[model samples]
Target chain A: MSGGKLITGFAVTATSHTLGEYRARGGYQALERALLGMKPEEVTGEITASGLQGRGGAAFPVGRKWSVIRPDDGETHYLCANADEGEPGTFKDRWVLENAPHLLLEAMLIASYALGVRHSFVYIRGEFDLAYRRLAGAVEEAYGAGLFGKDIFGSGFSCDVFVVRGAGSYVCGEASALITSIEGKKGYPRNRPPRLTVRGLYQKPTVINNVETLANIPWIIAHGAQAYRTFGTTKSPGTRLVSVSGHVTRPGVYEVEHGYPVGRFIHEDCGGVLGGRALKAVIPGGISTKVLTASEIEPHRLGHFGDCEDRRVLPQSAGIPHLEPLVFEGESLQAAGSSLGSGGMIVIAEGTCMVRVLQVMLRFYHHESCGQCTPCREGMGWLHRIVDRIVSGRGRPEDVDRLYEISRANDGTTICGLGDAAGYATVGILDKFRCEFEYFIAHGRSRYDGCLECLGSS
Target chain B: MKHLIPECEALKARLPQGFESTLVLPCLRRVQEERGYVADGDIDALAQYLGVPRVQIEEVLSFYTQFRRQPIGRWHLQACHNVSCSLRGAGSLLDRLRERLGIEPGQTTPDGRFTLSTVECLGSCGTAPVLVVNEVYHESMTPEKLDALLEGLE
Candidate 1:
């Protein structure tokens, strides 16, 4: 609401997904500009100058990611746009995939040209029927219009984009796991050291980007780096498409600049909590982020968790204390022990029990674990069982400590970030709402009078 | 093995000859789509058709939760029981479903008309309390609306 519409401009148009409508809006012009006038390196340079970062959970610099690719190294390179929006409370990518399919394709074309990728894949979630249908249609339209395949735009650069549907695996959102899924295997993440950049997707150099991250490519190409940086903060620049849901009166996707406040986002943009109820807590990013209380929501701070010494621990250590706290919409959600992951702000109204929230989160992580690592596979289920007991009024006071210990041990013990996500998801809730767990153990009921039955028992 | 399903020939003809293990997931999906669910015989037939090891094909089948190993009823109701949906009374909605259908989560009615289950998240949290019946999403689900949806579904 605060920033001008960059990505979601065509969301309301009924025929926005069509290539005709997209071309009418000057869609593939960025590809033409990059392919005809500028060199691939120049395109990557512009993106690096724009200070664009991945809009996915990990905010790695997008241009830097492209800069790492050895385009002319004679080895086949692949690019994948991660469209598996499986993260709970995050649906912004779905919006782009459904409404602006060609924008993503056009962006993919520019990115593939820059990265020297011949064949690319959009690994979309199978559940997103509309996105798949529209994207498949868009790809066909591009192929037919001479926009894709065999020296596109007569620029001597050829790239083919394929849409690979994922079969309901949350772990596939991770890059390596997605590659594995594309190879027709279980979506288990491989250990690093041989990063996906080096050997990925059938043992070739690969670049996996988020759908929203790729969508920004054409805009940056058309408008230039300086114009792109004018919207967001210096450190984390550009307008972000946030999906605000849960307890909000007007719950949907909103495009806002980096410095916008979290409170205003919930109050002004989202029309506050449903039925004008008092706000209890907000999960600034997705369910993976720790829940932020109403008071903490006033200063919505945003920062990449990568900068910290330990992302699992809150009140970021003195690793870079001198650096000014990166502001997300004018507030520090991080300072309050949370993050703006995937821009999925889930607002919790009053009368909701914190114990129930933790239970649901733990259960999700438990179900999604790929069973590759001992700590995450076993530890997640253990944590879920402990929370399940506490919610059912069969919990011991020691169960809370057990939950914290399990989470702490699970952090950073797996090949992928899913383990850290599981640990952080539970530990943050416990740190913020220990009282709710205590009350449940003592009085055999949630502080907010939630259902005492173990919802996580199944 | 019994004759492969009719779609199996078309799926096989589309393949680039020989067995490409990468096509296992897509083949299984197609088999499941043509037929309601991937039965054991179908797995054997697909393994024979694709020349893939039955164990390997089974691994793919078990890895993804979407590939139904057993037959599903006409109305396969999956409700989101994650945080957002749970906050919006998914628990009670789930309970109401159990009461109306006379089956717990993951159980099918004796009549084979309804099979109820729960999922982590449908990614439709904005419209919390979302329910998916046969891959079609029904958002903002309530007891009354669920009853009406079921009534209209057959």
Candidate 2:
């Protein structure tokens, strides 16, 4: 709440998602202001200055992705909103879709004007019923109100939005695969040299952006980039929608500023670990980003960790030079050897089996692997089988090393980032809790008495 | 198939030009909605109707998990067994249901009322241990709640 709400400024009501409610909240004004007043390059210039990072997972700069297109280049441009929110433990986009759909639409309209897009698309996963309905409804309303079509607000800029729904394929969440999916093909990621902006979506210049990243455009265009910079840390301009789940008492979506401390965000904002349990580890971002142990997050809580001899209590190695300084930003987290990838924080409480947790993560990677690349297709299965063997009480001492070897094989071996993502998750957990894997292998069962679920529930 | 000529033409008209293949997924979904599963004849007919290759339709059908080839039971139970749900007894929840139905994940019950399956993350981790029966989500599930849901189902 401290960073200041932009898209979610209005409270949720029965009529909140309606176009009338959105117009009352001053929606589409950004489009009016942009079309009637500014040139295409000027809008893109403002976005580049805002430093808005991609909210999908990879913190790629949005403006940099947009800057590649020239509106007057005589080539038809396509702007796509990647609403395939399939990342595990990430549902923040669903919030925007269900509540502030018009914000995304208005933002898309402004983006279309900036990019010279005549036809745009929104590719959302099929699992989302309510979210899809709301977005489709918003699109219909806009078209009916003359917001879409040949001329809008007498600006002569013609744009139309098509809502393309995807079947249940996680790989389609990838940019090239999303385009391929929209093209009515198997969702296979294309090798880059064409880089989407060059040749994409029926072999034309296309710009695919994450849902949350595009939602910030209206805010940036409404107020200048300089004013947007006044919100969060200069390095990470504006707030992030963090979807916290797992052992947190209040497991929901939260709008956190960039520089907000992870410790305070978890302990105070999320109401701490459920059942007053001590925090064990935090998977900062999706399952792909590296896992941060409890002490690594709050290095100042040395007193809380108590014993210096305990292997998990050492936060000094987290690379924090000052006290209470670890905050939720891209630069700082990257410096600490992790990232805020997708802002899907899965909080773990004490008394949970870290080995079992890794097993779950590996299983996801295995199941969701697109099978397009050899390394991901086979290596994911290898890792999943090894973890399954370890969890099933037949794990060998060499199995841990085998897991690492398979993880190494998976790194950079795939067409998309899925292979590397699996490797990072496997290594991140093994690096932090090698002892748990060893114990589970040696004892043929989990040493910890509990799982990722709450113990109070029967 | 003969009766569906107008429906196919209307659907083809609604989609974009030169992208006739894009209608493969939507055609499969529409057929599946009407018939529970997309039969081989349906695929062949859709290929002829949409002017796309049969292999293209087949690949798209097999590539996505949503486009099923087999007939599903009345209650298609898909339980999420990912990290958040795994933490919140998703495995146990599946185990209980599996035991009650006496079938594996891909198997249908003898009564033809239930087919249990494990799914990846449904993106509702806040309410862990989620179960979806015929496209409707049942979250924060308990043993009693699951049993009652089965009882209430026709």
Model 2 - which docking category?
Answer: medium
Cα error, candidate 2, residue A373 (Å): 1.5
- Candidate 1 wrongly placed segments (more than 4 Å): A299-331, A451-458, B1-19, B48-52
Per-residue CA lDDT of candidate 1, range A1-458, in tens? Answer: 67766787754778877888888888899889999998888889999999988888778889888888967778788899999998899989988888899999999989888888888888898777777888889988998998877888888998777667788899999999999987777888898869888889888889999999999999999999999988878877888888887777887888888887667778887888876666777788888877666645542344322211232444333122323333474235565556778988788776667788888898899999989899999999999899999878899989989997988898887898887888888877766666678788999887766842222212
TM-scores of the candidates are 0.91, 0.95
Could you tell me the interface RMSD of model 2?
Answer: 1.6
lDDT against true structure, model 2: 0.85
Candidate 1 chain A weakest lDDT stretch, 10 residues = A302-311
On lDDT, the leading prediction is 2
Per-residue lDDT tens digits of candidate 1, residues B1-154? 2344464454444232342555677677777777888888887877776677898777777888888888888889999898778867688899999999999999999999999989987778777788988778898888889888888988
lDDT of 2 at A453: 71
